[model samples]
Target: MMQSTTGELSLSWSQVAARRLVRHGLDTPAQGARPAEIVRALCGAHAQVVSAAFWSIGLRSASLTSTAVKDALWSEHSLIKTFGPRGTVHLLAAQDLPLWAGALSALPPSHNGQSQEVRLTPEQTDEVVKVIAAALSDTELTIDELSEAVIAATGSWAGELVMPAFNGMWPRWRMALAQAGICGALCFGPNRGSKVTYTNPRRFLPEFAPVEERRALTWLLKSYLSAYGPATPQHFAQWLNAPRSWAKELFNALSAELEPVKVNGSLAWVVAGDSTFPSSLPQSVRLLPYFDAYAVGGQPRELLFPGRATQRALTPSGQAGNYQVLLVDGIVAGVWHQRRSGRRLDITVEAFEQLSATQRRELDEQVERIGAFLNAQPCLTLGPVNVGAHA
Candidate 1:
């Protein structure tokens, strides 16, 4: 076992990776885990690709299936679909909305690379948020329905086609959708015949209110450290898509509660109580779907994406999770893809190196687990996954 010297903990990259896998519930599935519990542990599951998000959560949970995740969202009201860290669609625990919403609300407003004409002024943004809350309160509406409500409530300018979206321009008020989510005015509802619907977040947890900003940010920082710790402020900033300077300042303010550590001889930190790691190094193989939190949140990109993984699993610009990833012992080893048809699922993996016999058995078991989660017959094919990014 590696030992720590006085006054600081020195850890190898393998140790850090192992700790992360354990925290993420990837090393071993948690028995009979609740969907909300799993989502809470990982902070949130990226849900831009809804199937990938379901698989991401189901893979880490022993008995919970994809239906359970949906139940948590629509039936039990235990999980919420919202704009989360990096302003991406995510399924966060409903109980945690106060903290997540408050921390996200504290972020400096992002322009989303929009020009002044495409963006709303601060005052206009505020007005839009107010209108969205009023429109969505105790009711669900499709984008068109909500847009009509917003335009009727505001003015003709709010409905002007300007902001570019897929194949066409979105209405001017659409720019404030994410901002409304951050302000606790919006969340996703069950689809209305393939059309997505939005409703007030308060519909889930009535009496919901954002926590105070400083307390919420502190809670968020510690939560990130607990899940992906021994990391630097820069890692935190990248994960949250917050300003680097702001992240650095927040870390400095909370320095007293952070324990400095040496990860592969580089400086990093963990929450004071979370510096210890398990003795066992991770040996489990995990097939993570696109935008999996473990794939997206792992820090020190080079260490997590060693060798060919950097080329195979990551995007050209160094973003993780654009492609499905094969993880060997908590590090990206290659790429994988799944094609589902009817009740059958075909999985193809492109590993960088040949796997040992035992690892192959584990891989098979992982495939079976996914099949059970999706209620499909599973088949695994080992070969080159000839797919483009985000395929």
Candidate 2:
């Protein structure tokens, strides 16, 4: 019998989470997709819009049109907005939104009262609703069109213009739509300036049904733990951008289903009842897009990549940038990007550090798989290794 190496024996918490995502069909190797495979992997039986979006990007590395992304949103999932831990736009399922929002709401704003002032108030929000209803009821509007209508409805209140002004606007709109019980996106054809139309959530997904708020929250928490567990309250809190108290409460409620594992001396939650590790791992390469959930969703991403390498992957402002990640043996080994010149796809691979001869051969083989997935020929350009070296 072949013995498992110490590295394999001492599985990192990140690998544990990645394995669960794959088993649940939430993630796939970088080998591309067909539309049907995409739908089947994501929709499963639950059939939520968000899961579809997650499935699409996780498997294909493609960003669906707003409509495609929104088609996954459902009222059974709660959507709310508050500056989460990393202070970014995150569209969560409705049932999961309240506790997440409630947790964040309880925290002091990072910038004192000034930051809070920028958020919409109940009255102002009511006006926003009226405008959105009026504009979207009859026709679909682009983000710009919706922004104009909101400005008109609220007499140009700062909140109406807020969505367009901040980079965080999309998540805010998702929150608004979830609150209104109007899930789904108004996708545009070609460009934002082109024709746009509203789509019904039910029409896109017939199986989803709205559930009670409390029940939704419970289900949402379970789903998060199921897909992203082997994590801690801090990881949960960070992922939702909520408070420690809320994270603790959810973890406490989920105690029966979660197994505590000692990782690097810290306790992390793993899915209860599962003891087997994945027997066969994919031998393909993946190019994860910027802001990919796998990188951002995990708390202390060092579990995925080294600290110095992680910093280089993100923007100077600490935001995820548009970088293509290179995955080998189911872990992030390096980063890659493509320069397109009409018909040719010029690929560059930047290793976190020097690759062993075996790793290099594996990378070359994996790149071929990537080429097959994209249906294009790849011209490989190797960049300097930066894993262990200072930048």
Identify the runs in model 1 with alpha carbons over 4 angstroms from their true place.
Answer: 1-6
Candidate 1 RMSD computed on C-alpha atoms after optimal superposition onto the true structure: 1.3
The 10 consecutive residues of candidate 1 with the worst lDDT sum are 1-10
- For model 2, residues 1-391, the per-residue Cα lDDT tens digits are 1223432134455457456557434344434443334333221212222332343343453333333333443222222211223344334443333344343333333322324545555565455555565566545466566656655655645333334334554323333433333222221212244543333322333343444545545655555555555668887776655567877887787677766665555567665765355545544445554455555554556656565556656555443323446655545667776555764667788877677788788667655644554455778888943332111
Top lDDT prediction, candidate number: 1
lDDT, candidate 1, 1-391, per-residue tens: 3446655778888889889999999999999889989998898999999989999999998888888888888999898998999988999999999999899999988898999777899999999999999999989999999999999999999999998888899999999998888768999999999999999988878889999999999999999999999889999999988889999999999998998888887889999877779877978999999999998999899999999999888889899989999899998988998999999999999999999998899999999999999999999999999998993
Candidate 2 TM-score versus the reference: 0.65
* Clash totals, every prediction: 0, 13
